[model samples]
Target: MNELNPLDRIRELCEQRKWSYYQLSKASGIPYSTLNTMLNKENMPSLPTLQKLCQGFGISIVEFFEPDRNLQGLTKDQALCLSLFTSLSQEEQQLALAYLKGLSRTL
Candidate 1:
């Protein structure tokens, strides 16, 4: 796996939240234009901007910068399962879980 930087981390955070850049800008109280420009330019955020992104993600700067995957308390498989589950509709999720439960009983 590649080393994740603050930018990559913040993007993943936003994606996990199903947020648009505009949504993140509103949440972070940062200007949408600035956020767009910075990200498009591949420029790292200033400390203040980084802090705002962290705030938007409901994480402290330390947690945002923490490179350890284990801190999330999920195995890679679990994380993949969760992300896939999140992409499903509420009814689809319920049905999928029910099917899994049924299959488990036959094991």
Candidate 2:
């Protein structure tokens, strides 16, 4: 798979969260206007800006650079589900698993 530009990564991260550029600005503490102009351009964001973006995505820089979904072979839904599942309590996790199994039986 071709690599995404850093700016592309930022855009992809925002898209995955169903976030508007404004939401990213709020989460990253960057100005919305700045992000809007920067993300639309070819210029790479500065390291500090990148850091803020990573923080907004709740991922490390290393994870940021990891292979994206095309290479990782996870569909968008699976990736989102995994992320949400990991954030749940153990009891909630068990409940979700049971729910999935029950749903599958009805399918």
Candidate 3:
């Protein structure tokens, strides 16, 4: 993955959270025009704006600049499993788990 600057990182996190720029602006109470300028101009957000984003996400400002994938969260395997489970139908998941459990009992 390409390295992301602070603005890029924030944009990515917003996407990951399923937030639009407008959503972030509204939730953060930062002016939409200011946010648009910061993002478009690649200028840094004001400390207050940064604070609002960090607070909105329940993370610290320092943590926000860290590698996007390296944020304190699930391991890759855990993330994969989560993704897979979400894709499975409830009955398919139950049957699959039951089959695995049966195999475990026999071993």
Candidate 4:
């Protein structure tokens, strides 16, 4: 699926939640005019702004980064594992895979 820009995602969230820009701003403690400008002009939020939005919506940074689906659907441990896996060097990846296979054999 194509990814929506951050502002587009925020706009969609607001519409789905039946929230006005002012309501979102109030909820997020972001300035109403800034939120309005972002939504109206399709401007991307800064990292701090995105963080505030996620916090206001009772969500995590991973959730905000996932444009296609809700992050709440994934367990915290699963997300953490995935993050760690994706960051591994190629050699480290091979080592981890081998370790897992060895553990599986023992079990």
> Which candidate achieves the best lDDT against the true structure?
2
lDDT tens per residue, model 2, 44-104:
8999998997876667787788734333778888877877764454456689999999999
TM-score for candidate 3: 0.57
TM-score of 1: 0.61
lDDT of 1: 0.76
TM-score of 4: 0.58
Q: Largest TM-score belongs to which candidate?
A: 2
| Higher-ranked by lDDT: 1 or 2 | 2
Give the worst 10-residue stretch by lDDT in candidate 1. 62-71
Model 4: CA > 4 A from native:
67-107
Taking all chains together, each candidate's TM-score versus the true structure is 0.61, 0.63, 0.57, 0.58
**lDDT digits (tens) for residues 16-50 of candidate 1:** 66778888898789999999888888898999999
- Assess the local accuracy of residue 94 in candidate 4 as a C-alpha lDDT between 0 and 100: 73
Clashing pairs in 4: none
Error of 3 at 34 (Å): 1.1
Which residue segments of model 2 deviate by more than 4 Å? 67-80, 85-107
Residue pairs with backbone atoms closer than 3 Å in model 3 (clashes): none
lDDT of candidates 1 onward, in order: 0.76, 0.77, 0.71, 0.72
